[model samples]
Target: MTKLISQYTALLDKLDRLDWLVPTLARLSFLAVLFFYFWNSATLKIDGSIFSPSAGAFGQIFPKAAEAVLYDVTQLNIFQRLVIFGGTVAEFVLPVLIVIGLMTRVAALAMIGFVMVQTLVDVTGHGVALGSLFDSAQGLIDQRVMWILLFAILVFKGAGPVSLDALLRKRAT
Candidate 1:
């Protein structure tokens, strides 16, 4: 019994020593989603002109409101347009920072906020159905909650030793 307990403790310690594994995997898994969903969207939102979106980018980003405005998002004020652009940029930038583990804690926190706003837009602006939080993955909110949890973990634990943030910390020490 004593030997079995000792071996179990040793195994738990080994797992603890690899604490970086889950956070790194979370960031990497996020990367797969970003490459397809975000980079593609970002590229679509920008054409040859700097900061200028293709004709339909805004309509896609704010579909419901755009329809209310007869699909002319240009009717939005300068500040509103800038907000859209900023959101688009963040959707691209924040995820990249997280993947590289540079300023990962900040990036993850920002991502949490981003996820919240994105979910809000989906729910309020697009009229997406809200599922009960306790209900099994019934709608977009549940899926987003899972994403936020991943970001929250990084926000608390930070990038692990394999990350750029960790490397910089070591050098600074």
Candidate 2:
């Protein structure tokens, strides 16, 4: 029994040495799953130019308000416009920062907040069902929670060794 325990400990210790792969794989997973998801959404928000948001942007971001204004984006208040613009920009920018491993923790943290807001918008604005945790596999809450967990991994572990953050840290030192 003691020899078996020793062998198990040695095997676990070997696996522990690959800790760097955790963050790297987390970033890769973000790139693969979420990067383009956000990119495409951002594209839909823009109309003629990147600076100009489409009618769909207002409808998506502020559903009731957009309906109130009849989807005329120009009718939205400055603050509302700013929010839509900022959200659109973040959707495009945050994922790139995470994938490139630049300002990773901050980016991931922001992504967590973004996911929370997105979930709220889906629930409140779009009427998506907010299912209870562990209740079922399908719902805005469960899906967004998983996305937030992925971002949390980056928040805690950072971009790992193969990242620009790591390179800059090495250079600065």
How many clashes does each candidate structure show, in the order listed? 0, 0
Q: Write the per-residue lDDT of candidate 2 for residues 39-119, one digit (tens) a residue.
A: 999999999887788999999999999999899988988888789889999998999999999999999999999988888
Error of 1 at 104 (Å): 0.6
* The candidate that achieves the highest lDDT relative to the unseen native structure: 2
Residue-wise lDDT of candidate 1 within 35-75, one digit each (tens)?
45766777777666437755466666676667778766557
TM-scores of the models, in the order given: 0.85, 0.95
Q: Tell me the deviation in Å of residue 166 in model 2.
A: 0.6
- How high is the CA lDDT of each candidate model? 0.78, 0.90
Against the true structure, what is every candidate's RMSD? 2.4, 1.3
Candidate 1 regions with alpha-carbon error over 4 angstroms: 1-3, 47-50, 54-56, 134-138
Angstrom error at residue 112, model 2? 0.3
